[model samples]
Target chain A: MNPNPPLPPDQPRFLRLFLASEREVRRTVLAMVPSLADAEDIVQQTAAALWEKFAEYDEARPFTPWACRFAQHHTRRWLERRAIWQRLLEHGLAEELTQRREALRPEMERRLAALEKCVEKLPEEQRRLVTGYYYDRTGIGALAEAQGRSVEAVYKMMQRIRQALLECVRAATAQEVEA
Target chain B: MCAGCDRAGGGGVNFPSPEFDGAVAAVCDGSVLERQAEELNALLRTDAAARDEYLWRVELHARLACDADAILGRDATAVSEPAPVAQISWRRAALALAACLAVLLGGVWLWPRAASQEDIVELVRATGSVSWSSEDGRVRPALEAGARLSEGSLTVEGAASSAVVKFRDGSELTLSGDAELSFSDHGKKRLTLRRGAFSADVCPQPTGHPMVIRTPAAEAEVLGTKFSISAVAEQSTLSVETGRVRLRRLADGATVEVASAQSAVATLDATVKMEASSRGVAAARWREDFRTKPSELWQGSWLPAEGAEPARMATVPHVAATRKDGTKVITQAVSRKDSSAGRIVSLMPDSVLTMKFRMQRSKPVTVLLSRHESSGAFAGNYELVVPPSTGQTDASGWRTVSVPVSSFIAKMRGYQQPPSGGQVSLVYIVCYDAKAGMEIAGVAIESAHAGTSTNP
Candidate 1:
């Protein structure tokens, strides 16, 4: 079976995951901090904190749900610092979080667009290799054996391919402004 | 492995399969992947340099991915701290006292202690620039006119004049004209250039308390590295020369970690946008503001005008003709005093003493062109309070402000009376603030015939 199946036009799994996680993080943080601004600050802090502590994460598990748990912890800490009345005010705050989640979707889409432009500029074979690894989760060993090359050679080639793609994006964007 | 390749040969070779693995290892280690990978990549129709460069980036990506995995592994369960000993227990109280003493001592050794109030210095200038000359005669412009310089902190009126500051740690910063900048000399340094263009090459301290450059539009902090920043009037731009700089805009408050050769521009009214450059292109420059050569100052020395009396109390120093942006510098030693102010006095007849230099600051500066009265005591008169708003931060290109000696020191006895009879000893271009000191970085005095005569 082909591992890299295209998503349907109606399917918004990527968008859904991005927005849902962003919204949940915001909502969970707001539960602790009564102020919308303060909640946003905590959410951002939590995201950065998550990134900084990324080594603790397990790639096998889902990232969004795990990130939401971190958001909840930070939110609880924020709420604990506030007055009792603030706690009562935020009881139904999560219900209003959908708007913020939807608002962030466009920004994510734009970044994805930039990423697409960057990836397209990669050499054709490199592009295929990246797509296979990221999208199809193909093992380096399997790829190497299939091509009758060692795993080291395959991994090294993959590394160069990724670097080339990154450079292509940088040059494209830099020239865009210079032009 | 081929016999030639096994000897760690130079470029130009077709390597066997085993030698290719060695070359791949070399690329992974960031050395030039000598012959094998280059040859194989050629066969694979891949760009050799691109492949080598990508190896480093992919390693970083894998590291980041690994870090993500580690963060996810933290036990979500809360770990409680040990209970504090009750005051009722005498042994616990003694142990707590020892711990407190140890902590205090350790902190004193680890962190620099705050200097006593007497050790604190307050140097202020309203409309002057300050520069430091090294033993080798290399003069560094530390602050520009219409700016204030104090103990480890420099603030300029964003609209008046921009300042290019170099910290002791080799961090170079150019504050956009008219921005307020404050720097703490602590190991974990802090810089707050409230509004204006600012760029720095920050060296991080342990505990990684970022060296912060705060502005109206954004805040850029670094752990340890080189970078440049231009805090435009309403927008701030950050470009990393080496290492990573974290930029956080105050609006949506998005934070981005900018790697080397990458730049981000954030404005008060716009969303933050970032762009990256090729590594070689970005690493070449680390400073945000550029200055003309230091030797430019020594190139044109003042020569007494023909038929003019050797520089006397009444005669203004003569300088070679200069453009509107050109600066004429006069050097003098200043004595440290318990209570003192900077004054420019002593003039010669037909003297056209002009205070012309670049200005960058946001607040109004009380520029005093003062000379001592007959009593030989410092006096404040002939003050030109240039408004805070009148300079460019970016085109900052160059503009000159010329105040005639007659107009500048008119209120003084020499300018008020005949230039021959009145004696002017001390002159001052002092900021009115008793604390926020000003820096007179560069100054020039044009001969009376500055406009007409080419020879000094």
Candidate 2:
């Protein structure tokens, strides 16, 4: 690493902890907000907030859970300002979501592991679609336009692929459980 | 196939969930209908099982969609994609073929800094006046060819100017026409191009940290790709010539993965949604009826085609113009330069530019075309000045003007020649005065012989 210059002494520590916990913390925010875009924004804001408050953090305890707490706070604050999120949050779903998402983390991780194989198993056409839309980050509209399909048609195909992958992962998990 | 997903089946209650699955998929796809959002929220709000499924699906989406490399591996993701930067020669390459600086310099650089300064990048080539400075506003040193630079900012000034740099990793970044790039290969390759255009043929980066290019409106995360970026204050546009790039708009945190030959725009203020990113407009196809989707190529004051026929109309924008005295001028005309994140089509010699609009008073409308060498350097500018109409107009009061490419007089200073063969990059329509009440309803750059309707 080229000493990137500007830093406090503990900057490396903050970077190490943040990089490790980023994926989990991102999942937490994704659970809060429906938008991957907004989740990314909240997670970025949470990272900034965490770095500022790093001195206050009890380093002995796990940083993942601490970063997650900040992520949840930013997600809620982000949601609070938007009228679209107002009705969604009226039932006070954040706390329940945080609690429930933690409960599902283990199985979800297993399913995520299974997804790699399942994705590889997809037909080349389907795999390219996944790579283009999911990996390449092509928008649904752009994907539709490129593939010469209607936007609705593309969404339906994506739904089918996700659903198929879900089934494939579940089967793989079941085989593991049985074994 | 399993009947239903059961890992999402904890709390032991599995409500038949095909409909729920569809809703969650829509959420992940960003195509969730308003009704679906409400329904999906209601299910999550009321039931724990639904929330379990939601978390499960979203996590899967997050890993597969956002964390693609970690899940699929780099080898699987990077291959078989568009790679437009395939032809770069390692020792030196022209920036957009716009720079013949390497041939001009003979030596790679004008001068190298003191040996003590860490040489991280090589200015392999440059054209016109290129400036260099440290990240902060100070340290103004004029940079020349083959100069090894410590991590800092570089700006290629003038429409005709360009520069290409080779990084420590052999990655090549090209800056064209009034663009500034502040770059560092420190921990990972990161470039901040706040304004103007930057193109690159990136070398594959480390597994986790991809190269990042930040503009005012968005940032592009590149994992070894051939791409070009153009940005103004309000928007940053990314066009991927090869491979793919993920462009995230800072305004909405929205990101789109642009693939080869495709472009995506992230805007900070414009209300006009981008129509098409794929740009291969035919000579006859180059038209603006002000209907349906608005092209990213246009910016102007538009109005509904009133009186004649009530049909579909796109957007209405106000186009202000410069008066002869240079006062009473809005001077801001709809331009190809500002929104030129699209097709780089060269104008055939006989190309005719036309416009349909209504003016409150008779005023001369000026059409200006900014041309560049086929190599992408600004050659000169030409203008066609149409005198105020003394012709009949339809009941709607819209007058049509069509001027062939040959009619445009050489109006450029410093360089004077007709723009007969140069690639036409900038096209705009201006009027003598904004108060002349000109509202442009349509415009087109067409081959001279292409049929055009004359509004009676």
Candidate 3:
């Protein structure tokens, strides 16, 4: 078995502790809460309360399991207050999946920033096409007419643009992880 | 029916319309297979494998779209509302189209449109200076040197390198040095600071008439009274000398009011912090001191000759007249015995003071100067007596007597000392009972002066 390593005690590092075990703790809290919204609220509250109680925690042990136990405690307390929200807690998969989604937020935001930069560097005409479709709610058919091209041709262009952007975001995120 | 699909199958779905395709692209995140299925459903109809592949492609697309939205939205929202920018671009396009159409349709006449008052006002600056000239000879406002303004269309040239502009309400705005200013607005009251530092003591016009100062960074609105605003490329500061000013971030629409003697700063996406400015309430004594410098009944043209020697003309033939209503309304043309003999004593009050000119007799007549109660003394106790002409042919004009209350009461005996510091309390002219039918023709009392004298 891997020996429990000690966290640095010299400086306040509760933030690091919270970040490291957020996923498991969030999942456990979500399982006991009804609705993704309620689960998210409960997990946030539990994290804050747990951080305040960090002085009571043993630093040498695994952080994730310990935080999960605290999260479960708070989730049970939250469920006790409202009967209707407790009913949503019966659907175990929904709550569990939502926690996974919440855990992926940091990764998603990072990827999103990367994809945005690549899209902006596109040629003005292409940028317009993308903006017209995404922001203006303009259809490819209207874009086709404006460009004096067939609808099918516009569709093909959009498909290529989408593929290019996806590739760009993926590459950027991969580079970030490596760095 | 939750059909789990992938990216490859998206191409096969025969979408009802292209708008549906764009909507799919906007809402769906490409990494989510569930969203990918939704996108493929909008685009095509296909087998489960194809649908799954298509879902993958859409998931990728959705992710890409999110990225694009974030990057662009961040940069764009950091600027002003996109609607106007978009409209500006659209206007440029429309102008180009109009130009082309004008050429095709021959002989199109475009009327000359005069720029708006907002355009004219925008030339005013919070700081710095500018010079303006107008061949039309209309007095216009200028900007201070090195000050900046916003985009505006109206341009007015200064009469000189620098000159003072007197607003309609007799307030002065000084624009020093060579300054150029332009003001523009879209039929709304908006100001664009074009150039130079120009200071104006603008009387608060009606509401909705906003005084806006535009700098490179943001716009400052003078909601009320006095303020001085200055702007550079990266920062804009509005300091209120008096009253209040609201500094608005034109880009982000954030606003903060700078109260009396306080300054607010606007830069980039940062919050504004108001600081106390060392420059306190600007010198406004000039405005208060500048009374419409009183002129003669005739404009201000009449003046005493430089070296004229004064000679005494005492008791020159005098006359007084009773009005049709038995009120002694005296005029120089009516029943005047002498015009030059009346000792013209000027009464001017330095501050607020009330005084009464009395002509005592057993009975009194209405004292009228210029056919009106120059003072309302007649309606009260004293009988404003109109003295009849003893001999002369002209209207009953009496020799004007100079009697300051201090000197006149000193000669007579009991009068109370004026209360606050030596502020003169009252002025009384006693026509020693010999002039029974005597009329107090003209009496003038205003902001008081130092010494007493008679007009010979």
Instruction: Give the top-scoring candidate (lDDT).
Output: 2
lDDT of 1 by residue, B191-233 (tens): 6655444445443444656677776778877777766565546
Q: What ordering of candidates by TM-score runs from best to worst?
A: 2, 1, 3
Alpha carbon lDDT of each predicted model: 0.40, 0.62, 0.39
What TM value does the first chain of each candidate achieve?
0.42, 0.86, 0.43
Worst 10 residues of 1 chain A by lDDT: A82-91
2 against 3, candidate with superior DockQ? 2
Candidate 3's C-alpha runs over 4 A off are A1-179, B1-173, B177-180, B185-188, B269-456
- Order of models, best lDDT first: 2, 1, 3
Cα lDDT for residue A167, model 3? 70
Q: Is the docking of candidate 2 incorrect, acceptable, medium or high quality?
A: incorrect
Off by over 4 Å in 2: A1-6, B1-19, B82-456
Clashes of each: 73, 15, 80
User: TM-score for the first chain of model 3?
Assistant: 0.43
**Which tens-of-lDDT digit does each residue in B1-456 have in candidate 3?**
101122223443343344334434422311112233344433333333433333434434434332233445443443322634555344223322332333334424221211111112212122111323333443323333112222333232211123233322222243422234444333233444444334444454436866566766667765446554434346565555567667777667777766764666666655554343433221101101112222221111112222531111111121232222333322121111101112122222232211221222332222211110111000011112333322122232334432222221111011122211221111222233344433233334333533332221
Q: Per-residue lDDT for A89 in model 3?
A: 32
